[model samples]
Target: MMKTPRSFDHIDTWVFDLDNTLYPHHVNLWQQVDARIGAFVSNWLKVSPADARKIQKDYYLRYGTTMRGMMTEHGVRADDYLAYVHEIDHSPLEPNPAMGAAITGLRGRKLILTNGSTDHAGKVLERLGLTSHFEAVFDIIAAELEPKPAPQTYQKFLKRHDVDPASAAMFEDLARNLVVPHQIGMTTVLVVPDGSQEVVREDWELEGRDASHVDCVTDDLTGFLQGLGAKS
Candidate 1:
């Protein structure tokens, strides 16, 4: 059995990952982004779809994010990569009233902590009608081009916000991205994607431990927040 941390007694700041964690992955927004990324890799590298997929997966495995791998291996600029990859149609992401209520329900200062660019984060939050939900959106650009899963980036965030690590709760969709925050003493909640049968991914297990640091793992964000005593 995984050891659960003590109930988050000290938390007063809630940091959320904007993409898959804020909205259900079934919304398929990321599916569109993935297709775009695959196409970009195929066209840019002059590779077939299979090869592009392989490269993308391999890079994501080696580096915490594909952009990091791209920069290290192909001299890709961070700004250009973010601009190209996040250019998705926002029409599909209609404002989710339930999500908005859940955000309003949660206590304390809310912030978006994502590996995405701030402009992309703004667009997403705007589309989801969540622009007012957060006090700030800390994007990858804020980290001096470093992405999540990097200890320095999280450290930098804490310093920038003047946040006490022990008083923050980080809710993230990707398990790999939660490792550093967990290590740094934040209450970590894994927003398990809806409809996923597997409790833990093999890659995340190999990259870190087997979800032991996670305080709670749930698919229903609204319900989970309610369970935590959030009031709408």
Candidate 2:
């Protein structure tokens, strides 16, 4: 059954998650990063590929992100880890003029709240041809290395951006990341893959599909934004 889409007429701030939210997950952009992470774990811990895979997934489950788990357990350097993991080809993402146009037509400020570094976000936005659409990019470094699904990080992002949660709408690929946003009075939109099964990288990612916290669910971000702009 199609749930009635929540109204976002009061929304003045548009927040988005970078990686899969900005670009489609089907592009397999995260696959490169995932492989790099596994390699990092294998080399750093001097473990077998199979063992590293276990640790990688375990960390993702225990902590919001593998990086956070590594930092807490192994005292890993964030800068080095982020640099290595994000060192991948951005050529897979073609310039999305429709997405860019849709975003540009939205009212008020548009911002990116990503667990990735500023450098990584810049590379993606450049490839997507959306470099000029966003007003700011709040990366992990700005959040003191804390990732999404953390209330503290969301608080910091809201404070730093001076965003009123009541008048804001956040678009994200992960359903868990929308929880805090929804709890804090922001309209939450979950951007799931179109006509595909949910890609479960972690346990938390698989939860929240019932749309209890989500105000809206959309497979087509560009189309959603276009409709939103037209209504506005």
How many residue pairs clash in each candidate at the backbone level?
0, 0
Q: Each prediction's TM-score against the native?
A: 0.89, 0.94
Off by over 4 Å in 2: 1-5, 196-206
TM-score of candidate 1 to 2 decimals: 0.89
At residue 4, what lDDT does model 2 achieve?
Answer: 58
lDDT of each residue in 21-88, candidate 2, tens digit only: 88887777988999999999999999999999999989987688899999999999999999999999
RMSD of candidate 2 to the truth, in angstroms, is 2.2
CA lDDT scores, all candidates in order = 0.79, 0.89
Candidate closest to the true structure, highest TM-score: 2
Q: Give candidates' CA RMSD values in order.
A: 3.0, 2.2
Instruction: Tell me the spans in candidate 1 whose CA falls farther than 4 Å from its real position.
Output: 196-210
Worst lDDT 10-window in candidate 1? 200-209
